[model samples]
Target: MEPQKINKGDRNKIYFLVIVIAALIGTNAYLFFKDRKQSERFVTVSAEKDKLRLEVEKIEVELDKVNALNLDLNDKLVEEQKLARVKIEELKASLEKAQITQVELDKANKQINELKTFVKSYNEQIIQLQKDNLFLKNSRDSLQNTLKNISNKASNLENENSSLNAKVKTAAVLKLQSAEIIAFRTKSSGKKVEVTRSSTAEKLSVRFTVIPNEIAEKGHHNIYLRVFDPAGNLLADEGNRFEADGQEMQYSHSIFINYNNDNSTYVIDWANPKPFIKGIYTVILYADGNTMGKAQVELR
Candidate 1:
């Protein structure tokens, strides 16, 4: 049997096949290793991102605690705390992206560490602030104790002066039920009707009801009324001054009513000098040295 030798063309074809097979094998090896490296890089980056996110969340929790402490910190510290929280939020958002680079992860790690440092510093400051607040609170408590002793002595003195105090306090107490100011005018037929127009406003009718009080002394009592314009100026006539609890004050009008242990109604009319301005007017009632009631009227 004669062995047939391979032709040059066939040899070339076999070499070409071998070369193609070798190239494919090399390409497959390269692809496999490359995929493996990519997977490893992905896992590493994911781990870093997750770790940073967790760190950010921890920082967020600490920041919330700091804010919830309600410490009276300086404005600069407040701003710093706000900035730290914002940074943590930003880092979390960035880490949640679909794709992140190693360099970016590195930067995030650095930023997170810096934030941790900032939080530590902030915590130290908070501790110091707490100490200082405790000192201040202790000082305040000590002062309060001293003031309480002084107040006890003063209370003893006040007991010695109880009679005059009772007189002043009793004279200043008032139990008013209702107070109102009505604008009205007299018709030509000598009839009075309610009017809202300032031009027709001729009288400010002040009406009030005083309820009975067992604590208040029962006798003839004079009620004083002070009317004020919108500009907070007292509206009163000349020589309308009287002393209420040793304080001299000018009043718009005074009414004398026999208040006998029961509800008493009184009305005092104030003559308007000119047309009342279209604005809000305030009427305050005073008896003794204390304000009893207040009413407001709008003229249009």
Candidate 2:
């Protein structure tokens, strides 16, 4: 077949159609590439937003932990807890933006780092407080123990003092030995002789020996003598009343003697102001608040 030759008008129409088809294909390719690029950008932005949200959640969790700790801490840690919570709130508010940029995310991340540092500092403080409390408790216990020991020692000293006082009191009592009583008659010539008749008796004499005791005290002592008739009548002199065992009683006679912690004999005499009518007279001697000895004298 011979090649067909087209005229100028037909060739122009064919060239226009070819150009229109190339334009349509180029427009489709451009639209497809633009749509794919837009979708990729959307995915990247969405992923960044989700990651920032996760970072905010992490910060919130840490803040919650700090808040929980604040509940258990003392008033001293309250301000720190409040500041940490404020930081968390500020970070969360920043994340509420419609579009989160990388710069903003970085800023939030810095705030989180600050919050973490605060939490670490709070933990250290709590640890130190616990240590201080333990030290104080130990000191208090030690002080209590020392006070208890001192009290015990003081009590022991008091008891020892009491015991020594008792021993000294016991050692100071005087001992008495042989006792004698005699009735004598004094004549007009002032000579004394033993008398058995009551009509002739002028005086009654009492004699006693205080035994030597090294433990007893040496001092001036008052000796009291009491003489009683057979009818239980006390032969007391004027102004001879004294105290003995919290009671006042009359003594026949009293004499002051200087004790030297040696065996010493004492003689006490009672003059008969009236006539002696005693069948038997009892004589008692007292010294240093105790009975020293007793004796009896007989008269006809």
TM-score, model 1 to reference: 0.52
Candidates' TM-scores? 0.52, 0.57
lDDT of 2 at 21: 100
Q: Write the per-residue lDDT of candidate 1 for residues 47-110, one digit (tens) a residue.
A: 8878888899899888889879988989999899888878888898899999998888889989
After superposition, candidate 1 runs with Cα above 4 Å error: 154-300
Q: Taking the tens digit of each residue's C-alpha lDDT, what string does model 2 give over 138-227?
A: 999999999999999999998998998877765676656788888897777988898888988888887778777787778888988888
The clash tally of candidate 2 reads 0
Winner by TM-score: 2
lDDT of each: 0.85, 0.79
Error of 2 at 136 (Å): 4.0
Q: What is the lDDT of residue 222 in candidate 2?
A: 90
Worst 10 residues of 1 by lDDT: 167-176
